[model samples]
Target: MPKKVVYLVVLVFFLLFHPPVFADITVVINELLPTPSSGNDWVELYNPSQNDIDVSGWILDDEGTSSDMLKIPDNTIIVKQSFKLFYVSNRLNKDGDTIYLNNGTSELDKYQYISSETDVSFGRYSDGSISWNTCSPTPESANSNCEVIVDPTPTPTPDPSPSSSASQSTSTKSPTPTPKATSTTTKSPSPTSAKLSPQVLSAASESSLILASSTSASTSPIPSMEATQSALSKTKVAGLLVGSGLALIGLSIGFYFWYHRVLGNPKKEQSENKT
Candidate 1:
């Protein structure tokens, strides 16, 4: 009876405290891409695990601000061998960016950067302590004792003219006339050379003029075939994630049932013995 009770307790503890099967899955911030806009940056996540892992509830942070916690559905798995790109709204400032991945109450990985440069030190959260990655050294990672350090050289930023001065300059400058000589030489005659009747010409002048629009309107903005192929390759990663999530859900359910059955049997036997 006591043995059965002990077994049940152990099972409960395991369920409560033990890490998930794929908890060993490591996610590295492989790359950060800057967008044309300031807030529309993206970060790439690389799954360096041998098994598919679910990143649901995994938090992605920029600098110190918590952005989003990924709510990956069951059957949504990052494949054993794959790279996942997570689009982050906040831009990765060269000054610093800290990315932390946590599971429930425990943190799994913490990447701290003083400068978003070539080499940075990443720390792994293990046994409630941080283990820093120190092999790759940069100006920021020079301090071996510290988790991360900033580069001595400050991050370069584009110089902005004072708003008042800029506005004043703009107001003072005389508007230059569009050089008629250059315009006459550059502007080609319309492809449609059909002579318009007086009535048609009058009507056309009264209505909107199509050829007067900018030439950029005629160009194709959609991506080419090569770009489409690249996009397809990136999208294929979603399949890997989906498969991993399904497997995790299956494992979690199976473990729950198996634990209950194994532990519950002993409890039943103990009760029978007591009776």
Candidate 2:
């Protein structure tokens, strides 16, 4: 009958009827090992949230068109921040297949693979990124724990066959000629020897000039390592000098302003007050 008692009763009723704030618990298909080395095809579910989720009524199926939902076993619970591997004992399509995870009414996650290599998994990464090549077969482990599989041996390319004409030529090839020894007779030069023709002499002179020019160009001087080191040292010293000068200038400007504010202002204020 009292006012305070009535208000307390009303507050209690409101508190009891208010909907509870549930945590965001998302269960994602973290990893899929459709073609494992020894076991049946399994999919790993990751619970990244802090709250424990009950997957007892959840359904997992490969049915894209028909009702082929496999009911999760009773008492099926995935603890908070853990991975749960569900085995799909049925034969999965190696060429391509679609996998769907759902509750009775709504779908949780859906993954479809176009093609998957044997013993290689195609699933999401730790960051929930689904890519065919980025994910590897982890089976019972977390998606992040899966190592990227890289084939070290490169694929061998088939050698091109030789043509019929080329094969025949190779089979009937002639042997390489051996060098035959010949005696050399040197002609002694005499002052009365006939002089070379003018055209031939001109051509020889031009070729000699070209050879000299090329030799000079190729032998042009390049900067030595010591010279480069000296230049770098000079540049570094110049930079240091510039930086020190700028720092000194900044300090001078700051001191000028600080002195005017601290010492000059007080004297001017006193003079103004006196006036």
Q: Residue pairs in steric clash, candidate 2? A: none
Model 2 lowest lDDT segment of ten: 16-25
Clashes of each: 9, 0
lDDT of 1 by residue, 1-275 (tens): 99999999999999776544754447555444432233345554556666667776666555545444343344445666465665555455656666656655566665655554334333322211234432232221122333433347887998975798788888889697797654332375544555455799888876655554544577669888999998898888888899999999999999999999999999999999999
Number of backbone clashes in candidate 2: 0
Q: TM-scores for all candidates?
A: 0.32, 0.43
lDDT of each: 0.57, 0.73
lDDT tens per residue, model 2, 183-256: 33345453534456579889999999999999998996999999999999999999999999999999999999
C-alpha displacement of 201 in model 1, angstroms?
99
